[model samples]
Target: MSEGTEPSSSSLALLHHHHHHPQQQQTPPPPPPPPPSTASPSVAGAIVRGYRKGNWTLHETLILITAKRLDDERRAGGSSSSAHCSPSASTPAAAVPRSAEQRWKWVENYCWRNGCLRSQNQCNDKWDNLLRDYKKVRGYEARVAAAHAGELPSYWAMERHERKERNLPTNLAAEVFEALTDVLGRRAARRANAAATPVSTLPPAPIPLSPPRFPQPPVIPTAPPPLPEPAAAAAPPTLPPGHPSASGTLCSPIDITRIHLEMSSDSSESENDDGAGTAEPEAKRQRLGSSVVRSATVLARTLLACEEKREQRHRELVELEERRLRLEEERTEMRRQGFAGLISAVNSLSGAIHALVADYRNGNHR
Candidate 1:
């Protein structure tokens, strides 16, 4: 009985060893420890879980997720969804992700890029209509983004069909049309106002009339009148003997005859002396002729000197006039150049002002 029991125990041990070894081989190494829990329940995880559990609405979920993603992307220096999702891409419009934060960012960027802040009611009509449609279709967030970007389908039959399917309101559509009409009216009014405005242009200055200067008549020197010829010197007269004639009686002819002979001799001597005096006057007349010639020569020299002085004065006046004309021409040229420069400056200033006004309106003043 002891020997039989020992054999049975060995068989049992063998059975146990075979069973354990096969089981160990078939167990598959306990499935490699379940890969560790990498996903932790942080704020983002809680939000995502809440969305999946229907604790948050679709729009709210989208908003929260978009905000989280954007923040992460920004930190990582990657593109934001709002910037990457453009309508020009081939991606279906509905396929684009829905997020309130992304929509808001898209709208803000669109308005800035297209200068919609200053846009008139008519300019904003399409966006308004799109918003209305989006609200009806539960796509308000998307509408907001598209409207902000100032992008809408063109006015056409296709757009109309799409709008109808989206259940857009007729009243809202009418408002958009009305806004366009208002814009047209305002533009027309502005054009009319511009036409009515008067432009001021200064009249050309009157041309001055200068008085003409006439040349004076030439002056001629007048000659002095010639003197009349002097009369010949009068002959000397003889006197009677006053003492003999005191008794009032003349001497006898015979007695006088003897005295007459002596008187005749005396008369001859006197006549010779008179002839010599007459010859001296002829010499004096010749000397007077030479003095008159000298005076005439001096008068001619004075007239020539006066004529030369007048000619010199006239030449100086002509030179001065020419110089004045040249100076005036130079001044006119300088004024023309200055006027051109002024016009260029005014144009540049106008352009700068326009750019500045545009930047301010777009909220880009900085």
Candidate 2:
């Protein structure tokens, strides 16, 4: 019985020794390292390639593998057509309908997850185009603010600013009134001056003509007492059969009167001719003066018209400048208000995110 008990004890000890060995206690190899997780970099490349081909989604692993194989093709190159490419296609189709804020968040996550080292400017340019579409759904001012914040594209910002300037209200009536006032005042002043000026209708003075002067000869007066005998009495001499001399020359009173009358007629005719010749030059000078006055009047009228036009243009420019300044002020005020709203919204969003993170951490801890 002792011998049988000894053998039983020895067998039990051997079993115990084997169970205590380090090799037997070792853990099985960790389930073969989880089969390397079939999802790979090729999957991401495939998704990008699908986007290039206008495919909204990629379901097959083969497509993903092909995308990985042709990774260089995804980059914009000479052969690639921008017309066929959709920038948003590079993102997951499921995320397309997300809000601008959500899209931005996803982009940030994507960069981080993929270990992309793109610059901030590159990120801004991408978001800018995305925000332009959001602007159509949102209002103009909201879109403008998003663009200014780098959430929208730079081109959209410029276009929106231009539109705002074009649509701004103009004060045309004020300009018109100012122009009218300046024109009417100048016209009224000119008319008043014209009315106050005296008009002269009297003929211009004739140029003075020097009178003809005759030299007076010295006068010698001789008083003769003897009376001359009649020539017919002294010459009554011969002529035997004809006594023509005796009838002597007795002057005819009618003949002398007729000769005097002829002389007076000649004098009257000469005086009339001289008067007509002297008046011609005076009439010509008067007409020339009238022409000069008329020319001056026409020139003054033309100058006044030109001045009035210039005054009107100046008034318009002034009004335009004022309107532009007012618009600038209004735009500045609007920008200030929008910035305030943006700041408030950003603060609220940040607080919400922080709260969400805190909740997640607490839940995890629990």
Candidate 3:
């Protein structure tokens, strides 16, 4: 087909098909649906329990979820913020769909790694209901704590006081006169009694006209008495019989051995004393430890008692509120029934009066 002839429509179609058809290869089938997500049920359950127990906050859960999602995205070779030049070019990861249950799973895994939770089970609906009730209890506790903290005054007491003040009629004249008499009488009596009291006849104390004299001390200290000189050693006694020189010296050697033995006994006794001293301290420490344990146990029991009482009081309050509501409902129903009966009675009375009037007009009383 020459440019001048302008190719026919069928010829153009054939050329177009030839150019594009060969470039297209058979499309491969999509990889089998990703093997069911490998999420651990244990991790999910732990997250749920921890949240319900108030051990983990919602903020922390959100952080863990975000980190897990980002990690997952990275592993899947998804684009990150750095992959783009402009900040706006990358979509925020938070924009992705995130649910509470999904976040809980991430938190559970995080807690597991941190050793925050011990058990690994699926967080079931049971725990969810408990957590809801627990939140309500916590809210009531917070309100109580706030009231005790004096963030808001107790309105009930204030209202009671106001009512009392309003009911009591004031008498200004009587109050003022009584107040003046009570104050002035005591003051006048005090002044009169002071004036009537006798004065002491004792003379005034005398003052010295000259400077005080202090005791004087000698300039030099006396020398201490000299120590007495030690006595000279006595010569060894002469051998009595001279049967053998060694025998006489034998007694001397025996004396030296005795002295040595005495020194050794003293040392052993000192060691025994030292051991006894050390044992005393150890015994004292044991006693102190026992005392501390006793005190701690007492404190624990006191706190436990306080907590139990507080819980009991809250239960009573809830019961009272339910009872009040029930009573109000009953009262409302009774009032409604009373009104209906009252209207029926009025209608019946009117009918009887009308019948009596008709008989009177027709002389039926005859």
Candidate 4:
């Protein structure tokens, strides 16, 4: 073919390469960047309904209130969550049944938004269970006392004392009154009307009988007995005012029964005093035990959360390490392929140049 008609060797070589490789079609665009992992608002809203959220029992509710009160105490002491706080990005629920933690949170929110409550006792759930728990504790205390005394402690008196000290009757009365007020509005009026009603329908009392007069012989008044002769005065031995023998003190009392009764009464008073004295200590011990239990619970939860966080971080680190090693291997493979392609292209160009030179040399010789 003529030089003008045929394409140049270099150009033909480039055309051959393009025809074989064709530039690498553009790479799919990279998967669209993975959809966000969060749930849609509409779906979340549908899941949070009546039965979905757990129920709040009476005791649980009471505990929630106590927890709320504690939170208030903490907040009022100037601790705040503001530094790390951020508005939640998640969609709001229409209504969610609360877990224990959520219930406490709700209680805190309510307490903070509304002013102080009138009374904790306003929760008039029958405290029979609470009373039973209290009694159980008392029994445990009695057993402890018995163990300490090396004999069974008489719990009857202690129980009576506990009843009054705990004001169980007062609590019951208050609960009953509150219930009545709720069921019967204007209980006072009913009570007053009942009091005003007459008792005239009852049977009358019996009449008293008059004593019969008895006849007795009249006797003349006798003269008083002559006074006994005065004995010689003897000086009493001097003794201290509090001395056992002071002021003619006798060794034995004339009335043993009276003395015994007085002694018993004194002993009873001492026992009462001892009971009262020990009560405050027992209360302090119980409070300390409760605080310890709460602290242990909080610590356990904190430790568990920390452990979960650590494991998550570890998993992320492992993933990152895996990704890095994979990328390193891919980069090394890409370099190897690029180097191989460069060498192949150079070799093709050299061959094309050599052929053109050989063809020129042959044409000149001819």
How far residue 252's Cα lies from its native spot in candidate 2, in Å, is: 69
How does candidate 1 fare on TM-score? 0.23
List ranges where model 3 is wrong by over 4 Å: 1-276, 357-366
Q: Give the CA lDDT, 0 to 100, for residue 12 in model 3.
A: 86
Model 4 residue 320 lDDT score = 95
Better model by lDDT: candidate 2 vs candidate 4: 2
TM-score of each: 0.23, 0.26, 0.26, 0.25
Question: Taking the candidates one at a time, how many backbone clashes does each contain?
Answer: 1, 2, 1, 0
Which candidate would rank higher by lDDT, 3 or 4? 3
For model 4, what is the C-alpha lDDT against the true structure? 0.41
- Candidate 3 weakest lDDT stretch, 10 residues: 198-207
Q: Give lDDT tens digits, candidate 2, residues 277-323.
A: 33333343454345435544665677668765765575577679989
Candidate 1 per-residue C-alpha lDDT over 30-71 given as tens digits, one digit per residue, 9 for 90 to 100: 676554333342443344422122132333323333333343
Clashing pairs in 4: none
Candidate-wise lDDT, in order = 0.41, 0.42, 0.42, 0.41
Residues 1-366, candidate 3, lDDT per residue (tens digit)?
476456676688877886787554223323343332345555555356553344434443333334444444443333323333355644464356556666555645665665444222332332333333343334444565667576543223345454245321122123332333344345444433332221110111111311222322221233323222221112122222222321212123233233233322232222334333333333433443354344445545665476567756766786699899999999999999999999999999999999999989889656
Give me the overall lDDT of model 2. Answer: 0.42
